[model samples]
Every structure is written in C-alpha cells, then in structure tokens.
Target: MDHHEGLRETYAGEWQGLTNSEIRARYPEEYEAWSRGEPVRRGGGELATEVADRAVPVVLDAVDKLPDNGTVVVVSHGGTIRTMIGRLLDMEPAQWERFGGLSNCCWSVMGQGARGWRLLEHNAGTLPQPVIGDET
Candidate 1:
C-alpha cells in the first residue's frame, strides 16, 4: 500500500480537532458561509477545491499504475473522498457537497470508460459484485 501525504485529510487550521457544536459555536459566520456552499475556507483552512487539487493528482497517479483490469482502492476520510469523487466525475467543486458524507469503513468506486470516469458506487460497505454486462 502506498502512503501519500498529498492524499491526507484537509487541514482545518483553527477549527482542527473541534467537535461539531464547538465549530458552530466558535466560528458561526465562517461556518455559515460554508454551509451555504459559498467556498469559505473554514477557519482559514483549505477550500474544498484546494483539497481536490491536492488529492485528485495523487489518485490519478495511482490509477495510472494499475494494470489492465486491475482495481485501486482509496481509503480516505469523508471530505477527502467526496472532493475526489466530484473532481473525478468532472463536477464543479461547489457541487461536491451533493455527495453525502460516508460512514466509517464505507467506500466508493470509480470506473473508467471511453467517455471518462463513472461513479460505480458510493458509500458502500460490502465488497463489489460483478456487473452482468460490464464484463470485458
């Protein structure tokens, strides 16, 4: 398994390690902007786009290494995974929030196609089953 610093979870700066209520109580305006999806950097932390900028390249690098019919699993936090998925699917960073947060141990799958990337699954906990017509 490869460990890449670029794939690390976003650094929330002043809001780091704080609980939900704590973040809401401490930085209401900033939190509100983020809640409205206005691209505010939470506590002067990285923007969601910035997170994708760093993370997508690392994931792409891994994808480039896979042999034919090989799969690469990316294990990361919810925010990181969400941003990466949005970027991978060519969605705007503002729309990335549409992806719901993942519970622990859940994973999403991305499939490459002639057109581009497709989200085969999201927030799944079980192993992948073969698709009836997807066989090569």
Candidate 2:
C-alpha cells in the first residue's frame, strides 16, 4: 500500500506528517509532476508502481504459508490493495488509476483452491440500496 512516516521516533521524518496535498503544494514543480505522473516528468517521491513491486512479494509469501483452500483477509490501504488486485488479475499498473478510487472500508476477497490463487472480488462498493416498502 501507501507509505507513511510513523509517529515512532525511529520511523519519523520531517516530512512524514504532511498530507498528499501538502506535499504537492510545498514541493518543487518537478517533484509534484513526477508524483502525479505528469508527461515527461519523473514524478514525485514514490510511485504506486514502486510500492507494488515491494508489496506483492510480501503478500505472495504470506499466502504461500496459508493452508490450501484457506481464506485470508488483508486490511490494507487503497494503493496496496489496488496493486494486489492488478497483480493478481493480470492488469497493467496504469489500470489502477483508470479504475478510480477504492472507497473506505471496501474490500476484495482472494483465495487459493484447486485452481490456485485467484481474486474473488475487488474494492466492492457499499451494498446496494434496498427498495423501500411500496416503492415498486
């Protein structure tokens, strides 16, 4: 998922507490452009692609430890989760931005069975609204 500077003394940095908007506003134009994937720009501090490169390995390692046909839940940030989705589903890295935001508390289910590891869901939105009495 996304990286954040933790409050722990060892993990904290001067810029750790700043939000994305703050980073964009305060940083140099090239930095912001890079972060945002602007044309011809190197982009900012870290790209989602880079994060995915690290996260997928750890996740697959953990999955390998689980029993066959077992179910696991990973509560992670949007970037991380989306990365997992793209990786598992054989989607391009850029596809994540195209899918748009993953709403808060949303989830995806992945399982390993006779068919091997697969994605059962991805960023499921809020439950569909029920029809009220007499609405029909």
Output the number of the TM-score-best candidate: 1
Ten-residue segment with the worst summed lDDT in candidate 2?
4-13
Models 1 onward score TM values of 0.93, 0.57
Q: Whose lDDT is greatest here? A: 1
User: How high a TM-score does candidate 2 get?
Assistant: 0.57
* CA lDDT, candidate 2, residue 56: 72
Residue pairs clashing in model 2 are 1-80, 34-43, 34-44, 35-43, 35-44
TM-score of 1: 0.93
C-alpha RMSD in Å of predicted model 1 compared with the true structure: 1.5
Clashing pairs in 1: none
